[model samples]
Target: MDIRQLARGTVPWDRLERVATILARRYDRDAVRVEFLAADNWLSIPCIVDDEWFVKIVTKQHTRVHALLTAGRNAGALSSGSGGFFTRFETPLAMVEHEYEATQRMREIGCNAPEPIEAFEANGLGVLVLEYLPAFESVDDLDATRVRALAPELFATLATMHDNGLAHGDLRAENLLVADGDLYFIDATKVLPDRQAAARAYDLACALAILEPRVGVRSAVAAASEQYAAEDLLDARDFLDFVRLRPDHRFDSTRLRSELEKWAALSEG
Candidate 1:
């Protein structure tokens, strides 16, 4: 991946015009409108066709420290940006390709992820086209009981993926979309190689953290523990104890590790 070869600027009016042409050909003109969503260091023109689908042309800027910090934080990486900085570790083409491969693998394992349509590379730039998750809404829209009911199933799906050799770099509610009662993952730029137990535990903990604030802390912990144990990612008793000591008595890495160790012990037994 040539980090230096990243594409920038949407100065070329043809790209926008091309997108408009494509959308107008496919859908009702009344249903579609092209807007310059952002035109700063990066450009995004959204061709929204009614409420069903949106075609977003995302152009990348040179990797900035602030952007990397934000992305790292979102990915649950170490929080202190003061001690270090992020480099252009991967090319846009490579990142898109990695995501495409991961999406394909997830689909094969029956884990719901956005369909990869096409990834275009031109003039040292890349753009990924994915299935628009129109009906999809964030998990934040749901109440406690709904989140509780959803956790085990979500965890099970993630577990299936991890068990079959895959890892998601960002496992957060916003990145997850629910449509017609099915969860669909959107962002896939940072898929990792299999670390089944670690990945499952990490994702379960993150899910519990988000749910705990909305649901009762106890209920969130129980739901997380239930899924972790069901998947045999952790032991019930150890996870229960770990949960009790969680930062908010809910979910954290310390507790996650304890629970994972318990599961490892159980497996050994």
Candidate 2:
């Protein structure tokens, strides 16, 4: 089994059946087809219902993992000379509900995101339902040329979120999807309300880290410069080393930092 599968744990077959039954009843169907996805997710058991609705079954274990990850992220923030900005949910339902609301907020702010249907508890498990995108590719799955073309829009969307007082506490290539030629964000994590600046810088750092490996340091920094000011980019620099520590992000941090500093200097001149 994959490491993520082990970390995500497994829901009992009967539990999944109960969830399917509940979904069938909620959707007014006699029965529903559940196709579990082998997603590299550590927080939930993701599945598709009748190829129409995307569902995430969040268990107690998932909540525990989320809390632990949040705590680690908080520590990372502290290392960047900022207070902890990441927030943890005490229950599975809270996790799903926050993600549901965050997705809605992103859409309300004119950003592309899947339509959140609902979040509810089924037999003590947190269940979140959303519209399924039949066709999409994660940024990580895209070619370098496509990623290069999409880089500016990615930063633009991030800027829009920041300008609207919203921050995607979790920003990574896998969390960003391209569907029908548009970028869609998913799985936004919770952050402290009063620590938007820290969260924003972290998000910027993650974006740069994601793009640098795909498009090179110069292109990544250039794309980021279009949406973020020199000072914003510099602030993001503080979080580069922290972001690099994540296994999901692999990039030449030293080179990326040099490129960012060069760009900032040129902007200052």
The Cα local distance difference test for each model comes to: 0.53, 0.94
Clash pairs, model 1 backbone: none
The ten-residue window of minimal lDDT in model 1 covers: 78-87
lDDT of 2 by residue, 102-151 (tens): 99999999999999999999988999999999999999899999999999
Q: Estimate each model's TM-score.
A: 0.64, 0.97
TM value for model 2:
0.97
Clashes of 1: 0
**How many pairs of residues collide in each model?**
0, 0
> What clash count does candidate 2 reach?
0
Clashing pairs in 2: none
In terms of lDDT, the best-performing candidate is 2
